[model samples]
Each structure stands twice: as C-alpha cells, then as structure tokens.
Target: MSYLRISDTVVETYRIVHYEQTNFLNRLHGGDMLFFLVETGMLSATKVAKGTSLLASLDDVVFKKPVKLGDIIRVRAETVYIGNTSLEVEINAFNQNEEVVSAYATYVKVDDLLRPVPVGVKIVEENEEEKRKIEEIKKRRESKLSKIADRQKMRFRTEDITEGIRYKISNVIHVSPELTYDGKIMSAGKLLKLMDDIGGVVCFNYIGYNNSTDYTSGAVVTVAVKGLTFYSPIRLNDIITIRAGLIYVGNTSADVIINVIREDMKGLKEHVATAYFTYVRIDKEGKPIKMPKYIPVTDREKNLYEEALLRRGLRK
Candidate 1:
C-alpha cells in the first residue's frame, strides 16, 4: 500500500556499557546488548509501519566479542524487506571499530486490536547486503511462522533423572507491572534478559558439574542464539516458570534449550516461548577451551542430542 525508502526507516543509537550493564565477570551482559538491539529495531520498524508492530521472531544472533564496561556501543537498525503485513530488520552492534553482535528480526504490523495488518511500505535497497537479505526474507518469515505452529506441540519435560550428564534449572517468578509495557504486556527485552541469565546458569552448572572431578575451570559465554520464538505474550502478575538444560555438548561449546510456561486460570501450564542458546567455554584468555563429553542416556536425550547436532551443522 505505501512505499518507503530504507534510509527513511533507519535508526541509530548510542549506549554506554556502564557498570549496571556489566555482569559479575565485568563484561557487558549479552542480555543488555540484545535489549538495546530489540529497542532500536522496534523503533525503526515502527517508523516504517507508521504504527505499532509486534516482534514475531528473532533470526540467528551471534555475539562475536564481549562488550566491556566503559565501551560505547553503536547500534544501527534498518528495514531490509517488507511483505504483505510483515517486515525484516537487520541490526548490528559495534564497539568502536569492531562488530560485536549481528542480528536480523521480523516484525508484523498490527492494528489497535493487536491483529495483523498490512504494513503498506516497501524498503529501498541501498547496498549489497540489503539486496542479499531481501532475497531470503520471505523464507525466513515462513520459517518463523512454522515455528509458531510447532509451539503448540512443543513440550519440556520435568523429569529429574540424573543418570547422565544433564542439568536442569527452573525458576518461577511473578511478572510485575513495573516490568511490562502498557501496564499489562511484558516487554520482550525483559524476557530476553531472563532467558539469557537462565541459559547462562545452565551452561555454568553443566561445566562445573561435569568437570568437577578433573578440576577443570573456565567461564561460559553466550556466543549465539539460534532460534527464539515467542508463542504467547506474558501478562502482568502472571506466574511463569523457566526451565533450561543442556541438549548437546561439543568440544568447547554446548547448546541449551529453554522453555517458558505460564499457569492458566485453570492451573494448566501453557507454553509461552522456546529458545536455543549456544555457549562456549572460554579460558582466562578468552579462548575457547575443551568441554566435558556429554553422553546421552535416554531416548529423548538421544533425539535431542542428534537434533542439536543437526542445528550445529546448519550453522556451520
């Protein structure tokens, strides 16, 4: 319906990674960086759509290097492609001259009732990267939509079988009104922050527990988020539970699958979101180190292990 230039939809912002943004390890928190990215991308998309938009899905987000305190992060977002009612945005985070993170996200135009509506806009490609991303936008959007369908069948078992190298972390928290937008709906960035923290702890416990006998020591850092899908929006005061565990462990890396569920009025648990985060074991010098071997014990574990390998191969 409406045509717009990519330049007109671009948004750039600056952030100083201060002490509050840093983790206990003194490195910039990945969650904070992602929050910045999401905010910038959403702003840009809203400008192009000329109305509110909902983030449908997040593409492959890879964190190349750690953002340190006192570092200034330059975030840039641009609309790369537009569909009938959705658009793709490419976001990048830079620390000085080095690119620290890169991501692509899909957002859908929504009406006042929060229903999908036509964006009525077109993105004007201004570079080779933009052209290349445009060609794959449709495929990515399709894949994201498929994930939405898959979420209905997604399940996270709470089996506490400790017969193998497995770790599980669960937390139930109340979604306070202060953490939400419009005083009802939870912020996607806040959810991402929780996911990152839970996923990181899962990785940490996996490494610490598996290698305790060998006295192996190292730090775990999030390298990439493969696919994170939000099936439902969280509401204020809702009690939500997050469960995360390691599905596959490689030489110096591991893949963690996290599921978020909320309790309905009938006391039934409903799936809210699922995310896969890849973390690398890093030594004191920040180099990747070998991780403990993970042996699958159950049929479900075996299936998940194989699936994780397939996902890793795709990334390669």
Candidate 2:
C-alpha cells in the first residue's frame, strides 16, 4: 500500500439545524448530530479505502454543548489511524468556531462481497505533533481493546425477565430504500439515530414523563454514548427490531442499553449492534434534574447495572 498524509483523507461538511431535527427542547437532537458525524466519517474513511467503508464501532462520544436550532454545524472528519483492514476516524462538530461534540469511529473497508479488505493507503505523519497524536490514538485503541475483551467474557443466562426492568420500548421498522446508502445496506448514521430515539424515550418514560401534569415540562438529552459495536450489516428491506431498556439510574442521569436485531426474509434473526447511551433529564430551563431510582433484581439486570457503573467510572 502507498503512504498518504492524513490531510488527504479529510472530509468536511456543514449543515443547518432545522426545526424538524430539533428535540422537544428545540435543540439539535443528539442522534441527528450523531448521524451527521458518522456520515462525514464514513466519507473520510472511504477516501482512504478507495471504496466503500462501513462503520465497525463507535466510542468516546461526548456532547459538550447543546446545538441550538438554526445554528450552523461544521463537521470535520479525518483518518487518524490505519490498520490492516480497518481505520479510525476522529470527528469534531463545531458551531461558531467552538467545538460542541466529538467522537471516534472505526470503519472497515469492505469488498463487493461485504468482506473486510485491506485499505489501499497508509497514513504517514508529517511532523512531531502528528506523531504524538498517533501515539495517543494507539493508547486509546489499546485501552478499548482490553475493555472489549473483558466485556466478551461476561455471560448471563437468558431466562424470563422476572423483575427490575421498569422502562423499556421496542420498535419494528421496515428498512425502506431511502434508509440505505447504495440501495443495499442501511446507513450506520440512520441506525444510530433510531437507536438514540428509542433510548431517549426510555429515559423519558423512567423519569415519569407520563405522570407529569405538563408534557413539555422537561426533556431527556443524550449526554454521552459509550461503546457501540456493529456486529452485522442491516440490508435493505430487512425487518429490524430495535429495543431499548433502562439499566441504571444515577442522581441526574440514567443509562439505557439499545439492541438491534435484523430479521431476514427467511425468518432468521441476527443481532446487529448494541450500544449504551447515557441521558440526563433536564428541566424546561435545560438544567439537569434528579432521576428516579432504579433497583436491579434479576441476575442479568444486576450484571448490566454493574457494567454501567464501570463505564461511568471510566468516563470520569
């Protein structure tokens, strides 16, 4: 493979936050922002791959500031690390020259058969500063790998859920042609938006949204998204089931686990991806408020709760 500078793989795009894209708080929805980030990242990765690149995983997504409606969002994505067949893209979203959100995504170059293929280019650092950045990326990748290994070791019995799961919601959607990128596979950005939508609903329901006298008194906003791993490709016309369940609750925030399952025409169901989203209940003034307590009773629930705690500690 030939060596290429990181600048050669950079992609920048801009969008205006429309009213339809805003949440109940009249701010840009986290999921919509996520979609923009992932889409731009994919374009950057594709430039390096010289072909199609699919999202493999996303991590360390931080929402630093809320993007208001009518604000212009500038998104920049570039290939920061290159592996044999995979590359990591760092994306930053800015408004008025100030960064509001940032995320890191991993993409795998795939061939026509949807198999992982070697990326055609390698990244070459131009200066000492670039070299130091690459070193940091390597360290973060190593830490993430170690965590993934530990997570894979955890196993839980799949029995009937006896108790402790208070807030949960599931949605079944038919993957239409518009949802796909090439009329074959669904875009990762769309999938992430769907996951966040359901995750936000779970958080709102747990915070007694239905019991409140005023429906628009408060809102649930995404604070951060932990590790999101894509296991399979969602194809066009696939009947996908997205499920979101509340796992842990803190003083002002809660963690929701979202799982996506794809069902083919043959009635075969496959686990597509799983992600953990952290949401905070905010009052009408956008101030964070205390969330209701959640107690885990089942073995699975307890395990998930502990895992959420571990993730929270790592975030700090």
Top-TM-score candidate index = 2
Off by over 4 Å in 2: 146-164, 211-217, 314-316
Q: What clash count does candidate 1 reach?
A: 1
TM-score, candidate number 2: 0.92
For model 1, name the residue pairs that clash. 2-120
lDDT agreement with native, every candidate: 0.79, 0.86
Clashes of 2: 0
RMSD of 2: 3.0
What TM-score does model 1 achieve against the real structure? 0.87
TM-score of each: 0.87, 0.92
Expressed as tens digits, the lDDT of each residue in 46-150 for candidate 2 is: 988889999988998999999999999999999999988989899999999899999999999998888898886789999998899888888888877676664
Best by lDDT: 2
